[model samples]
Target chain A: MREFANKYGTVLVVGGEGEKCRDVAESYGFRDVITPGDIIKANAATAPFRALTESEIKNSRDLLARGGKLSDIVVEAVFVFADSRDWASDLQIMLDIAQSKGGRLETRSENFDEGPPIYFSHNDVLWSAAHEHVRLGMGALRKIVETVFEDVTGGRKLKTHAFGKPQVSTFEFATRLLQQWRATQHGLAESEPPETVYFVGDTPESDIKGTNAMNEKSKNEWYSILVKTGVYQAGTEPKHKPRKLVDTVLDAVNHGIRREMAKLGTRKDGKGRKLPLDDAALKAISEGRTPNFDLSVDPFAKAVAQ
Target chain B: MREFANKYGTVLVVGGEGEKCRDVAESYGFRDVITPGDIIKANAATAPFRALTESEIKNSRDLLARGGKLSDIVVEAVFVFADSRDWASDLQIMLDIAQSKGGRLETRSENFDEGPPIYFSHNDVLWSAAHEHVRLGMGALRKIVETVFEDVTGGRKLKTHAFGKPQVSTFEFATRLLQQWRATQHGLAESEPPETVYFVGDTPESDIKGTNAMNEKSKNEWYSILVKTGVYQAGTEPKHKPRKLVDTVLDAVNHGIRREMAKLGTRKDGKGRKLPLDDAALKAISEGRTPNFDLSVDPFAKAVAQ
Candidate 1:
């Protein structure tokens, strides 16, 4: 998140019930807040968007039963940050905004068909909330859109761009960010470059595949370090193998930075830093509190079935 | 074929334009013949229905166009026996007729999204017609209906039932017929059941899988015998193992019946005396004339890719 906020400038965070998502981003210095409910209320009567309950059946007394829609809110970066409280309403609104004919929710076309891509931030289709049962998240919405798109297009497959755990995109993006950061901190200039970037992740699919594909296709060498502290557990030796294995995030980060520095002839970890990654830093990230909530999902065991 | 006609009682033989398709089926003892043009002449308003070509592109005027729909033809049993000369017309017409509610012609409905169970005698998808490239057959027409159905129905995947080689339905029907024939030919009563119905085919997937599945699941047994002279080659080993490998149909038939007799308490070929599957007759069925048509675009292969 330190890297995220720095590189991407002031980001407007969206989606969350009454600012839970907004507050998390603001705490990380995002400095902006916008919610879908706010948008729907601010502009009514044309967006063709309406909110509904978790269950799909029409409710007589629902707020949206009286026909109104949202005005599109402009945000350069958007994320479907949390499990939606209302399934139909959020789906209708999010889909409306995402596919809003060049981003004007008030001016929507009257057809149920292919639409713009939604950047859902989390992969967990079901997560344990305060309730006894697991709650549905962005993944569930993603699956719904996928099915709906296909259904509307008469058997044509849905086109989507997804980037959470197990997807190659986010890890690749993160690695590129790390490469620039590591080189600048180590005083590497145009004439020099960092030799390697070690990706320390717990999931085998995304982390391992990212590193493997990176190793296969790029000049920025990355070593994969799979940690046992998160998504992947003991006993399943997946088809792809990581460069190294570790038991915890602190050990992974410490070993990763040190190994790269040693290999690159750099004198320290990220310019004059004599210490390995700090225990407190690792603890914060591992507890799912370090990076801005929009940038990262719960790092503990997420049921990312989608 | 004899059993199919008897079981169906009335097989409408279509596709012989100006007597070619009809000539072929009549030679095979199919008496009823109906061509598409005959229907349109009975109703002049739809004379344009016959104006379809196999490839209905705007500039395929050189491809002989047929004029008429399948709507006028009454068929208790259907055997689209040969490669279509004008697929666009045959396809549109057959599609219209098959989807007609309660088998009535000229009666339209919104639910053209599905059709009743239909059978094709030959499962040839593409075959050489003395042309340099493979030409379209009834299989191609079937595919067109499927594509259109998917396009109009909100992209719901169309579940079509097709017959011909490689579709288990056709082979299952054929094998059942063979078993009944065998039981009656032998002294076995209708109460006495089939032991094994050996299929000697030049194709691997249709013959091999059909025999294997039927053997595994049916009370009557099935064994696949591959011949090198047709769809399969001598050096090829099918993905699914056949019960026996033989270079010629004659050899396969001889082997299967002998093996069956060997299973019974007899060293004889069981000819004429209450059991007529002799070595000579087995050789005759195996040595019968095989057509020049292709049966290689097997449904099992299609299913595997799907």
Candidate 2:
């Protein structure tokens, strides 16, 4: 994540964690993290204003004001960062803007067949939650909205750009970030990406499939490791097989390090030499604790702080 | 249609025309005619009898009736005959019955994933009306309901049985009616079907395709004649090509009769001999007029009247 932020200079963190996630990203030296709310507000600001009718204005006691040209309004794209907390209002507002001409409220689009592009951060139909049963996720909501769009358009397919696990866009973005970070850190060519990248995750369907697909598409070697934690467990067949299977997160880290060491013909096990990654750092990551690092020696962290 | 009614003991007429269509069908010797209203009423009658609460009963001034077992209610199939007039209420009632346990209103299904089968008489997304442009039809309304159902069911696909001109069910029904009429008229065995049948229609996509498919599936031979009338205009390429194309309904009938006479090796023009189908009667039928028929000779009509 630090390497990604350093490469991008200003990273945008999109998720359902709201302000807390933004604060965390800022703490990690990300300066341009934004939320769906921010996008919605920006879109609303340029909305073509509709003046209240005479009767409505009178009822409002002259507090309502409206002065804006419809021609000045244009919404480039609408993004869904995460699963909405309030679906009805969120969908209603989005539908209004979608059906509006030039992003103008109260003005219907003359060509009702088309709408602005819609993007989503994730598209999981069902996600494991604290409850006994799985909860409906962002994908389910997207399906509902798509169905509604088809209905309103009299049976036209809705166009959408969805990203997250199992989609190529997020992996492409991540690869670009890693390449930029490597170039800034080691003075390597901007076009040169990492030779080998290991992605460790528990979910086989999304995480494994995505990494495998990205590996097939990209020039760099990509390996996926599955750990028996979170949603996945041992002795069960996975939807998408990973490159390595480990009992724990620590084991997954060790497996990746051993593979790299063997490939490089330097299998000393970090006994009398400084290693790029060690047990202490790997343990900290496995425990979900941010490891302490000296920014002076850590090129990625140093670049990120700046 | 008169010939069809004279063959079938009773025909179920489902549509938006309500009592007018029912009366017309009855006049044509159709003893059993059904509509959306009839289905709605039947479903409503079986709705679980929820006892009015204390305040609600008191508010009713002792006129409210209650105390019925929910087990007594069960709706097997739901049918949509045509475009709904009161969409909100109709949708609400249908949803209630769908989510109900065994069609018991107010009782949620334990499975939460299954529902009674839904049937649609027509599935047109839009239709030409008196107003300019196309208007929402029964099919459009069905799409909206299906979307809502998916939303409520957490992305489960709705089970639907739709039948219209383009669907094979309608064509099969038409063929069965024709066969029944032929058997009664010629004193042939019930197992016997016509050696050759002619289907004349204006629309190519619906009427022609359905007839062609039915012909492929049935033992009897079927030929389609396309006429330039109603929805099908001249010079437009049809999705489903017909066996013959004619300028008018009269020409279509003449074409079919000519082919039949040729096959029988008796190619005499109608002017010198009494033809099986009189031109005057065919003309009246083409103009949508009900011609007088001898009821004593019509077994189905006599059976229906009795």
Candidate 3:
């Protein structure tokens, strides 16, 4: 984000309510951040139908008080940090900036060739929210921006970048963080990464797909386990298939431990006998069911649980 | 509009700010009209991000106060009367009604097959407004609605009907109204319509296209004249060509009258000579320019102007 600021001078930050997105950008070391609210505050007619509340007006930074005319502020790039609270106004202001002459407000580029580059944090079209059904997310707004921009610009496509789940870079960053945590807390050597990492999530399109993609590209294994209870419906086949399917996070964890234990079956007890896995437990594991018996009661189960 | 209301029990009006759209529907004799604002006021969570103002809330009809549960109010059809003031909320609510089971609120249709039909008043993608450039009209909103609906519903196309310009029915209605006015005002026989109806408009996509279409189907001529002050920019060839191109509405009218006069050259004055048009005025008319002299001063021009 700082690199964008360094390259673009003043950047426009879209999404979130009030000054939330602007604060996030400033925290990332951006010297100057202009939000749609700021643009609207400077000129109410920018998005005529959308009226800012008194609090929103108060939250907005006055472009005139900052000692610069609204037209003088040239936004070189746009960063969408979160879902837009006011999609209409945000979309309008973003489109205005994207179509403006060298990113200047109120002036349109003749061929729409000089607008700023846009970046989004994520590209999930719909996400589970407080609403009964899934709500439109930042990805949906990104799609609208591209769509409406093309409509206004006579088929010129708006190029955008996203940096969240399903993107390889995001997965790589997560893997590096996990490795650092393992070295610091679990007594694992920094050089020796985990043999296999299990990822459990309810969204097949993002969580499962991204984990599977990372597993294909990375040195260590990334086993994706898709669970019910979110975007992925129970009875339907997901577009991106996970390595394993389970009913809950607890079941997924149990399945991973049982599989690892089976792989290490060759290692026996101190008496030189195979690890004591009773027939009932073995049957339960074979049938893809969590064992009914408490793992605490058995020595082998205790070792496997650890 | 009334026909739609007669067919569908309670229609949802999905545009205009506050009660503007609802009032239009009611004036057209619609017994019940439900705007997106009403739905939002009833259930704020329906479109969580869109917040209606106090006046907007007051303008909205309360579903609970009307003696029905929110879920029980089944919207049988959707009528978009004008440009949406709140695109985000309107889009969300419209989509909710569209994806609902039999248009019932808060219930998703299993396959999105049971939603109500939608109608748009006009399909102008961009319209000249108080703003510097063309603003998004009902057509743009319609396009977004269709695009987003497909995105959310997994490729099921949204079916919509539009009534205004470019549609053959609207032109036909206008022609009938013109004929009625001619009969009453000009004393023309009811059965004998005018030989030519000059349609002067600034938009080629809607006005010019509709007039040309009417010309193709009607016995009478409908000459389309395009003006430069709106959607159609000068120097570029329009996709829908007009019969005549001019600088403004006044110029369009002058050109039409000059063409009619030239066609009527065989008509003679009381002295048994061609109807008088002086050299300068004739040169100006031939060069496709409005004569510098006022039409009120010239006998021939006075007849045409009348």
lDDT leader: 3
Which prediction has the highest DockQ against the true structure? 3
Relative to the unseen true structure, what is the C-alpha lDDT of residue B283 in candidate 3, on a scale of 0 to 100?
A: 77
Model 3 whole-model lDDT (C-alpha atoms): 0.80
Worst lDDT 10-window in candidate 2 chain A: A57-66
lDDT of 3 by residue, B1-306 (tens): 567757777889877766878888988888878888888888887787778878988878888897877898889889998777777778888888889999998888988878898888998877775566666667878888888888887788887788899998998888788889989998887677778899988777789889999999999999999999888778867878999998987778788878876665434554333546788867766676655655455555654576
Model 2 steric clash pairs: none
Better of 1 and 3 by TM-score: 3
lDDT of 2 by residue, B132-180 (tens): 2233456645665677666555456666667787787787787778778
Q: What tens digits encode model 3's per-residue C-alpha lDDT throughout A65-163?
A: 868778888888888898787777778778888889988877888788788888899987777665777766677778888998898777888887888
What is the i-RMS of every prediction? 24.5, 12.8, 1.9
Candidate 2 share of real interface contacts? 0.04
> Candidate 2: lDDT of A231?
50
Go through the candidates in order and give the clash count of each: 11, 0, 0
True contacts kept of 3: 0.33
TM-score of each: 0.33, 0.39, 0.86
* lDDT for each residue of candidate 2 in A271-299, tens digit (9 for 90 to 100): 54344656676565455454454555644
The candidate that wins on TM-score is 3
Ten consecutive residues with minimal summed lDDT in candidate 3 chain A? A266-275
Each model's Cα RMSD: 25.5, 15.2, 5.5
